[model samples]
Target: MNIAVIGTGYVGLVTGLCLAQVGHYVTCIDIDTNKIDQLQKGHSPIYEEGLDKLLRENRQQKRIEFTTDYDMGLADKQMILLAVGTPQKNDGSADLGALFSACRAIAEHLSTDVIVVTKSTVPIGTNERIQDYIKQHAVNNNAVSVVSVPEFLRQGSAVQDTFHGDRIVIGGENTEAVETVAEVYQPFNIPIIKTDLRSAEMIKYASNAFLAAKISFINEVANLCERAGANIDDVSRGVGMDKRIGNHFLKAGTGYGGSCFPKDLSAIIAYGRKVEQPLSILECVQRVNEKQMDILAGKVSKRFRGLKGITIAVLGLSFKPNTDDMRNAPSIPLIQKLIENGANINAFDPAATETAKTLLSDKVFYYETIDGALKGADCSIIITDWKEIIDYPIKLFKKHLARPIIFDGRNCFSLKIMKENGMEYYSIGRPAIFPIS
Candidate 1:
């Protein structure tokens, strides 16, 4: 199969590489000359685990190619994938400028019958709109068919998730188009759910909103546990044991922040409002998620009486581990609050330092290593639960920091071990561990 992927962002890059790995010829199209140059040189523009290696292998085998030429990239391609970003606007609705631009480009360049599959997360009815848009601008009215195929891959584990996803949703009015898109992914052995274009688009937003709601719900429960002297960890464990609930996305943290949840939740709520059937629960979910970060910051502030002139070491700048994406990262707001309160910030992450620099600029200092970041710090805050931060040597922590006050935002460490190490530990939904008298 010859596939052309438009917009070589996270989803496009991963999709192209994964499809090429399965023996399909893929050409990823992007407008950024620098990104295309990097990809052509076997370097990934984004930092995703195992992505660069797969991309290099596929490029070496001539299975995948990168280019900025849309006319050339779309020529002779059987399937065209639109994986462009649909960023959220001020009104909470998705800004579809990029998506529409891609559609217009495809419409102009498409010379034959092609399946235009949308892998970008979009609002419901977007596929129908896309079909109409292409028809309006296309040279041949019946030459293109639009299909909605939303991606559900996580950032850190996207490669693995792409290959092992539980199900693939394909939504389109044309059966032939659906089947043609399905054939491309037939080798993955994942179950395929075929539905209408609207339902398929809604599934992506609904899925993300539900997961965000779950995280917020659990965080609220964790807050209750803290006030009620209950252990959220044990409660979560017991509740997760039930087959009905299942345990995924139960862990309480600072908040759910990344590219997907915040944008999707906002878009769904806005979509509901537009249709005069607003989702009140999701509104609360968004509110709670925003408050969670403030709560964490307040906890840190209350501990030190005031944040004025304190040196704070922040471990993990990315929203999650194994990816360098800083979109809507909780640390952004947390660090902002700390700085506003006169706290000096030192931060470190295994792979996010360079990315973090763009956001933090001179407001925060970036350290070469976690230990260096913690040195002479009054307290340490763990934002992302990267494996390295979770497994960091406790003795080194004791040796460097003047005061070993650790705030475990992700609960990445054991409470007992922090106690044994004689560190003042503060974690979500757990009893505060102070130095034993």
Candidate 2:
């Protein structure tokens, strides 16, 4: 199969590489010359575990190529996967500027009947709208068929998810269009969920909204546990034992943050609003998450009696570990609040500091080493549970900082260990751990 993947962001890059690894010749197109150049030189612009290696292998085997040329990418391609970003707008609707641009380019360049499969997360009726848009602008009305094939890949583990995802959702207007799209994924042997176009788009948004709701619901439970002297870890485990819940996204923390959840949840709510049916629960989920993002900040302020002039060491800057994505990362709000309260910030993440610099600028100090970031810090905050941070030498916390006050957002450490280590530890839905007198 000859596949053209538009956009070289995490989704497009991973999709292209993984598809090619499965024996499809893929041409990845991106408008950014720098990104294309980097891809051409065997470098992935985005940091994804196991991505660059696979990309190199695929490029070496001539199974994958990178280009900015739409003509080259679209030429003789049987399937054109639209992996472009459908960024969220102010009202929480998807900003389909990139998606529409890709459609127009596809319409102009498509010379044969091609399956235009969308991997971008768009609105429920977006595929229908796309079909209409292409028909309006295409050189030949019969040359294209729009199919909604929303991607379910996670950010850090997208490559693995592509090959081993539980299922794939495909929606199209006709049997030929949907089947052709399914044939591409037939080799993966994953379950294929075939639905109409609207339902397929809703599945993508609904899945994300439900997961985001779970995170928010757990965070709310954590808040209750904190007040009620209950441990969320214990609660999560006991609850997870039930076959009904099965314990995915049940961990209570500083809340869910990333490109997908925030955007997709909001998009669904926006969709509901546009159709005159408000998703009250999902709306509250978004609100709960926004508050959860600032939970650490609030803790810091309350603990330090107004963090004015306090030097705080923040461990972890990425939203989640194993990737450099900073979009909607809880650390952003925590760091912003710390700064607002006049706290001097020193933050460290193994992979996301450089990317964080773009969003956070010089507002916060960046440290290469966690110990370096902790050195001379008045108190420490853990925002992300990176493996290195989780496995960081506990004794060093006692040695490096001026005071051994640690606010852990992810609950990545054992409460017993923090207590035994003689640090004043604060975490979500757990009893505060203080040194034994």
Candidate 3:
């Protein structure tokens, strides 16, 4: 199968490479000349594990190419996958400016019948609108069928997810269109789920909303456990033992953040309002997460009687580990709040410092090494549980900070270990550890 993937962001790049690996000739199109140039040289502009290697292999095999010209990229393509970004607007609705612009370009250049599969997440009825828009604007009378085939790739591990995803969804009003899309994924050997266009669009939003709710739910539970003299780790373990609740996003932490959750939840909630189907539970989920992001900042302030004139070492800057995405990262708001209270921040993340620099203030200091970041700080806070930070020597915390006090958001250290090491430690939903006298 010949495929054209529009937009070379995380979704588009991974989709194109993985599809090319599975015997499809893929042309990745992007407006960014720098990104296209990098892709042409077999370099991935984004830092995804295993992406650059796959890009190199696919390019070597002549299975993939990159270009900025729509006519050249879309020539004779059987499927056009729209992987453009539908970012959230101020009103919490999707800003479809990029998606629409891509559609218009495709309509003007398309000269053959093709299945236009939307991998971009959109509102429920947006696919119908896309179909009409493309047909109305097409320069040639080509049969362009619009299908909603939303992607379910997670950042940092998107390549692995694409090869081993649980299911592939193909949604279209036309049966022939749906089957053609399904055939494209036949080489993947994953189960294909067929649905109508609206349901397919709704599935992407509903899945992300539910995952965000789970994270918020566990964070709320962690707060209760802290007040009730229980450990969230044990509680999560026991609760996750249930067959129905087999624990995937149940770890209690500083709430969920990334490119997907925050905006998707807001977009869906706003959609609910527009349609008069109020999603009260999801509304609460959003509220809970907003508070959860501040939990660590509040803890640091209260522990120090306020953050005035304090120098704190922050380990980890990205929302989660294994990727360099800093969109809506909890550390952004936490650092801002600390700075507002007059605390100085020295932060370190293995992969996110470059991206973090754009989102964080100039007042915060960046360090290449975790120990370097902790050196001479008054205290420390663990924002992300990166492997580097987690496996660092425990005694180093005592040697690095002026006072051996630690606030851990991800519970990366054990209470017993902190107590035995003669350090004061606080972690989510666990008893505070004070050094044994």
Candidate 4:
């Protein structure tokens, strides 16, 4: 297969590289000259585990290439994948400006018969809209087949997810077009599901919504456990033992954040309103997640009576581990609220420091090491639970902080460990530990 993937963002880059890994000749197209130049030099712009290694290997094998030229990139390609970002608008509907612009360019540049597959998360009926838009703008009356094939790769472990995905979905009205897209994934040997274009789009939204609902539901349970003096770990384990509700996304933490959940929930809720079918459950889910981040901040504020003159050490800034993405990261709002109350913050993350500096306030002190962030701080807060933060010595929190206290949003430490260390610890859905002096 000879493929061209437009928009070299997370999805686009991963898709192009992985397809080339599976023996396809791939050309990654992007409008950003600097990003293309970086890729051309065998460097990846994003921090995804195993992605950079794959990019370098594929470039060495001559199986993948990067370019900013639309005509050259689209020429002689059997399939063109639209992996552009459809960012959420203020009104909660998806802003399809980037997607539409890409289609126009692709339609104008396309020279021969090609299958156009959308690997981006889009609203229902979006693939049909793309089909119509492409046909209208195509300079030459060449046959174009648009297929809906939304990606299901997780950010941190995208490479693993790609090769081990449980199922692959292909949706289109044209039988030959749908099968052709399936053939692209035949190398992976994953199960394939064929459905209509609208159903495929709905599957992506529904999957994100349900996963978001699980996180919110567990967080609510964690809150109830705290009031009732029950342990969330035990509760979740017992509840998740049932085969019907497997234990994925059941951890009680600072809610779900990333590029996916928040945006998808808002988009679907808005669509529900447009169709006169209110998604009341999802609306409540959204409300619960919005308040989850405040739980840790409230705990910190109550402990100190006020945040005035407080210096807090914040560990982990990215939405999750193994990725440098900070979009909708819970740490942003938590830090903002603490700062608004006059608290100073020192933060550190293995991969997110550079990206976080752009999003966080200039008042924040970014650190190269966890000890640097923790040294002399009033107390510590665990936001993302990266491996380094979890494995960090317990005595260091005691040795560095002005007061040996921790407010764990991710529940990274066990109660016994904190109690044995003689440290004050507060965590979600767990009993607070205060050692006897």
Candidate 5:
């Protein structure tokens, strides 16, 4: 299969690399010349586990290529995957301008029969719009088919998830196009669910919204547990054992913050409002997530009387571990709140420091090492549960912090260890462990 993936972002990069790894000739197209050049040199702009190795291997094997020229990239391709960004607008709707622009560019250059599959997360009826746009503008109207094939890969484990995902959904008006896509993915032994274009688009948003709801639900319960003197961990375990709930996304943290959950929840709520049937549950979910971050800051403030002029160390900057993505990370707002209360911030992330520098350049001091970030700090806040941060020397923490106050947002350490260390430890949905003074 000759595949051309437009927009070499996270989804596009992974999709192109995975396809090329499976022996398909894949060419990734992007307007950013620097990024395209980087990829051509076997360099990945984004950080993903197993992605660099696969991309490098495929490039070495001459199965994968990268280019900035749209026409040249799509000229010989049988499948053009539209994997561009549909960023959320301020009004909470998905800004599909990039998607539509990509469609127009594809239409202008598409010469032969091809399936234009959307691997981007889009709203319902987006595929229909793409189909209409192609027919109206495509050079060869009768030769092109627009299909919606939404990606379900999760970050931090995208490569593994791609090959091991439970199922793939393909939506299109053309059976031949759907069959072509199915054949393309035949290397990965996963179930394929065929449906209409709208259903396929809805599936992506629906799945993300549901997972966000689960996180919010648990966080809400955790809040109640804090007041009621109940342990959320035990409560979650008891509920998760019911087989129906099945313990995933149940760990209560400083709420869900990433590219997908927060944006998807807002987009779904906006989509509902468009049809005059608002998603009340998602509205609550968004509110709870926002409040959770503030709650974490409040916990720190209450413990220290006030955060004014205090030196606080933040242990993680990425939204989650194993990737350097800081988009919508909870640490951003949490750190900002502390700074507003006159606190000086010092932070460390094994991988996300570079990306975090872009987001919080002057707001906080970046550290080369975790211990360096914690040195002489008044308090510590663990936001992202990176394995390295979790496995840091416990004694170093005891020696460095001026107050030894650790507010763990991700519950990285066990309660027993904190108790034994005689440090003031606070975590989500669990009782605060005060030091024995």
Candidate 6:
């Protein structure tokens, strides 16, 4: 398969490199010459595990290329995947300026019969809109077929997710186009979900909504467990043992913070309003997640009275481990609230320190090591569950901190361990443990 993936961001770069890894000749096209130049040197502009190595190896194998020329990139390509970003607007609707512009360029450049598959998350009827829009603008109006194939790759484990995802959904009204898109993934041997274009678009939004709902639901349960004197760990384990509900996303934590869930859920609610249908449940899900971000902050403010003139050690910055993405990370609002209350903050993350600087600026102190952040701090707050933070010995807090209090957001440490170590621990939906002193 000779394929051109447009817009070399997260989705575009991953899709292009992964497809090329499977013996397909893939060319990633982007308008940014700097980004194209970086890829040409076997460098990935964004941080993703295994991406640079795979991209370099594939380039060496003559299977993949990168370009800024639309005509040269789109020419002679059998499949053109629209992997651009559809960022959310203030009203929660997706801004389609990038998608529309790419379609116009594809219309102008496409030369042969091609299946134009959308790998981006788009609203219902977007595929049809693209098809109609391209026909109106494409010189070869009769030769393009649009298919909807939304991506379900998780950030930290995108490479594994691409090769190991349980199913792949490829939808279109055109039978030939749909199968051609499906055949693109035939090498992976995943289950094929054949459906109409609208259903495929809805599936992506619905999946993100349900997962977001699950995180919020567990946080709610954790809150109830705290009030009722029940153990969330035990409750979640018992609940997950049932055949119906698996254990994924059952962990009681601060909340989900990343690009997909927040934006997709908001977009769905906006789409529902645009269609004159109400999505109250999704709206509530968003509300709950928003409040969950501040749970630790509330705990800190209530316990410490004013937090003025206090130095607090903070751990973790990125939304998840193995990636440096800080979009919608819970640490942002929590830290901002603490700073607003006049608390001095010291933070550390294994991978997110530099990225955190962009979002947080010089408002907080960044530490080279976890111990440095905790040194002379009154308390430690664990935000992201990076392995370095999790594996750090509990006694280090007693040695390094001015006080041994830890307001843990991710529940990475066991309650038993905290109690045994005589460390003060406060976590979501769990019983608070106080220092033995």
Please identify which of the two predictions, 1 or 4, would achieve the higher lDDT against the true structure.
Answer: 4
| Residue-level lDDT tens digits of model 2 in 299-401 | 8888889989999999999999998999988888778888988999998999998989999848699999999999999989998889999999889988999
- Cα lDDT tens digits, model 4, 101-178, are 999998899799999999989998899999999999999889999999989999998888898898888999999999
Candidate no. 2 TM-score: 0.98
- Candidate 6: which stretches are off by over 4 Å? none
* Segments in model 2 whose C-alpha atoms lie over 4 Å from true places: none
- lDDT agreement with native, every candidate: 0.92, 0.91, 0.93, 0.94, 0.89, 0.90
lDDT of 1 by residue, 1-437 (tens): 99999999999999999999999999999999999999999889998888978987897899999999998999999999999999999999999999999999988887878999999999988899998899899866547889999999999999999999989999999999899889989999999999999999988988898899889999999999999999889989989889899899999899999999999999999999999998999999999999999876798899999899999999999999999999999999999999999999999999888888888748799998988999999999999999999889987888888898888899988888998999999999999999987
Q: Write the per-residue lDDT of candidate 5 for residues 103-192, one digit (tens) a residue.
A: 989889978788899999998888888888888897765488888999999889999989989999999889988999999998999999
Candidate 4 lands at a TM-score of: 0.99
Which stretches of candidate 1 lie above 4 Å from their native place?
none
- Give per-residue CA lDDT, model 6, range 1-437, as digits (tens): 99999999888898888899988999999999999999988888888888888888999999999999998898899999999989889989888899999999999986888899999999888999999999999886458889998999988878888888978999899999888888889998889999999999999999999999989999999999999998898899999888798888889888998888999998999999999998999999899899899899888887889789889999999998878888888999889999998999999988878878988847799999998999999999999998888999999888999988999998899999999999888998889998676
Top model number, lDDT: 4
- Model 6 collision count: 0
Q: Which regions in candidate 3 have their CA more than 4 angstroms from the true location?
A: none
The clash count of every prediction, one per candidate, is: 0, 0, 0, 0, 0, 0
Worst 10 residues of 6 by lDDT: 138-147
- Tell me the deviation in Å of residue 357 in model 4: 0.9
Q: Estimate each model's TM-score.
A: 0.99, 0.98, 0.98, 0.99, 0.98, 0.97
